[model samples]
Target: MLVRIITGIIGITAAAFVIQTGGVVFAGFTLLLMLLAWFEYVRAFSERGMGIALVTGFIALAAMWYAAWQKPELLALACPLIVLVMLLESVLMRGSTSIMDALASGAGLIYIGFPFTCLLQLRGMLPETVFSTEISSFTFGCAFVWIMFIGTWASDTFAYFTGTAIGRHKLCPSISPNKTIEGFMGSVIGTTAVVAGLGYYLNLPLQEMAVLGLLIAIFATLGDLVESVAKRYVGIKDSGNIIPGHGGVWDRFDSVLFTAPLVFYFVQFVNLLGK
Candidate 1:
């Protein structure tokens, strides 16, 4: 427990630093994480006798990250191009591969690449002028990303303690047996409170922050469960053991991966409704 807490604090500090210095630093860090996550993901699948295009998939991953970092709006164009490349590679390896192989490869790209890219998108939030409403402190800053991170962290922390204290009913006994219904509710309530406090401090939209907190709690739990399912299917406890006490990059960022896109679009919806 001590080791895990220490490692987690260090990891969070590093991530916060990168987020605060949002530019090449954050992009490079995210790119590294995306690649490592892809490697861990591919390793898991390959261990199960699933064939994937390694070089081609890496290229696609790099291209997609580049698109996200450099020209986010071109993501629509980049995605189809990636699929086309995957199919082309499948065709070239016709005797040894099928469309399924291409799809599996592409699926990894979408799963890891697209969501990791959302870090960049969330960091570069649309300007208030884009919505034509300068009502509150809705600027293109680190508040949204910080809210997502802190909210998810608070949710997980609250869930852990709550489950340890008085957890009774199982939430998902199959995928994650340790989780409990009491803990899940604790996470939702705890995250909402934390994010609401942050919103008040930062002069952000409190209503949106509260809603986003609930979304974070739910999706963060689902994300952790989904990773648990993946690892259980592969018969592995951790993804890569890259971090000292935490499992891997994927393990650390799993919840953020799920919540990032949700928060991104949810903020847009809030802005739209306001206008």
Candidate 2:
């Protein structure tokens, strides 16, 4: 428990620093995480004899992210191009790499690459001019990203304690035996309270923040469960031993990966509605 608490604090501190940095530094941080996540991902799936080409995978991953960052319009082309590249490689290798294995490699690119790129999008997305009069667009963008991070982290943290204390009924016993219905409720309530408070304090839209908080809790739980299922299937306890008492980059960012896209589009929808 102590180790978990200490790790959480350290992690949060580092996260705060980079979030505030919010430029090339944050981009570099996100790239480093995506690379670590890719490493863990390939290593985990290797158990099933999926021999993903590491060099090709990295190139495709970097290309996809570049499209997302600099050329949003090119993403449609980039995705299919990646799949085509994977398929070609698999065909060339014939007996060495199955088509299923090739598809899984593409799936990993989408699963890890797209969501990680959304973090950049959310951080860089500027708000409407009306709202920007009060708060700088840069500051507002940073706050939105903060809400995403905090909402997911709070949901996961409270769920654990709440489940341990008053958990009776199982939520998903097969995927994660420790999860409980009570804990799920706790996550929803706790995430709402914390995020609403943050939203109000930040002069953000309280109503939207409240709704986003609920969405984050729901999706964050689902995200954790999805990763848990993958790990269970892969016969691994943790994704990697990178982060002490917390598993790995994949484990730490799983909930954020799920919530990042949610918060990004939610805020954009809000901007549209306001306009």
Candidate 3:
């Protein structure tokens, strides 16, 4: 418990620092994170003796993330380019590649690439490019990303303690036997409370915060379950042992993978509707 708590604090501090900087600093940090996460993901597959085009996938992942950051409008073309590269790689190695291997490679890119790209896009939602002085500071955009992180962490923490204490019914026996329905409820309530409380400081409407919090909670749980399923399929317990107590980047940011994109679009939708 001590180790886990310490690691959590360090992680949160690092995240806050990068978020506040909010530009190449954050983008560079996220890119490094994506690389580590991609490595851990491929390493997990490699453990099962699965063959994939690591070089090509990494290139595509980096390219897509760059596009999302520098040119949000290019995402439409970037995604198809990734698939095309994956297919081309498969064909080029036809004699050695199996259909399952090819499929896994594609899935791996989408799983790791898309969500991380969404994070870049979310961070890039400032009034202008990172160089612009129109806003003078990244107060709003930074706060949005921070809240997404806080809400996700709150849900996971609450669910862990709640489930540990009095959890009864299994949430998903096959994928994650330890998760409980009670924990799920605790996660939702905890996330909502935290977001709503922070709303005032963030200068966001309480009602909007409530809805965002609920959505984050629900999607974060789904993200955890989906990751559990992937790990189970790969026959591994934790994604990696990079962090002493937190497992890996994937293990830590799985919830963010789902929640970031959802919140980004939701915020966009709300703004459009309000206007």
Candidate 4:
């Protein structure tokens, strides 16, 4: 508990600073997290003798990142190429690497990398991106980011307390035994409440922000569960031990992975509808 509290404080503080920055710097922060998460991801498999191509994995990430930064259109092209490269590497060295290894490695480069890219796109880092009309306003990006992070935080905090107090049934005993149905309820309701409360002040539509919060809570839970399942498959307790209590960047920021994309698309769709 002590370790968790300490880590939470430091993490929240750092995240606040980065999100507040809201530009290429914030994108860099997101990229750093993705890179760390990706490294831990591939390392987990490699340790299990998966023989993942580490150099190629990083090169793929770099290429994809460059595309997102320099040529957003090339992003689509880079993604499939990443998977193809990994598969080809495995095929050429079948004795060392397996087809499954290539698939997993390739997916990681996208799964971990793409969300961060979404975050970048969400923050309007790329040209002619996000908030269709408010091109120069970081408010559009920062406010949405606030929605995702705060909603996810509310979900985790409320779920922990709510679960401990009244949780009776396991939510997903197979993947994450500690999760409870009561906790899920708390997360969704609590996150929605918090987001609706703040969203109004942020100039977002209250009804829509409430819905976004609910969706964030749901997707955040799914993200955490997915990461848990991945770790279980890798036969590891946590992705890595970068955090004293939390585990790795993935274990810490897993909730944001899905929610970032969720918020980006939700906002864009909302904007389109408003038009």
Sorted on TM-score, highest at the top, how do the candidates line up? 3, 2, 1, 4
* Tens digits of lDDT, candidate 3, 106-217: 7778877888888777876754422223433445566678778889989898899999998999999998999999999999999998998877554567888888889999
Q: Alpha carbon lDDT of residue 149, candidate 4? A: 81
Write model 4 residue lDDT over 178-229, tens digit each, in one string. 9999999999999999988876665557888788889988999999999988
Q: What is every candidate's alpha-carbon RMSD to the true fold?
A: 3.6, 2.7, 3.3, 3.6
lDDT of 2 by residue, 39-127 (tens): 89899999877787677778887887777678878977988888888888788998888888898888887888888888887777764
Which candidate has the top score in lDDT?
A: 2
Per-model tally of clashing residue pairs: 0, 0, 0, 0
What is candidate 4's CA lDDT for residue 45? 83
Q: After superposition, how far is residue 259 of candidate 1 from its true place, in Å?
A: 0.4
lDDT for model 4 comes to 0.80
The ten-residue window of minimal lDDT in model 4 covers: 126-135
For 29-81, candidate 1 gives per-residue lDDT tens digits of 88899899988888887777777777777888888888888888888898888
RMSD of 1: 3.6
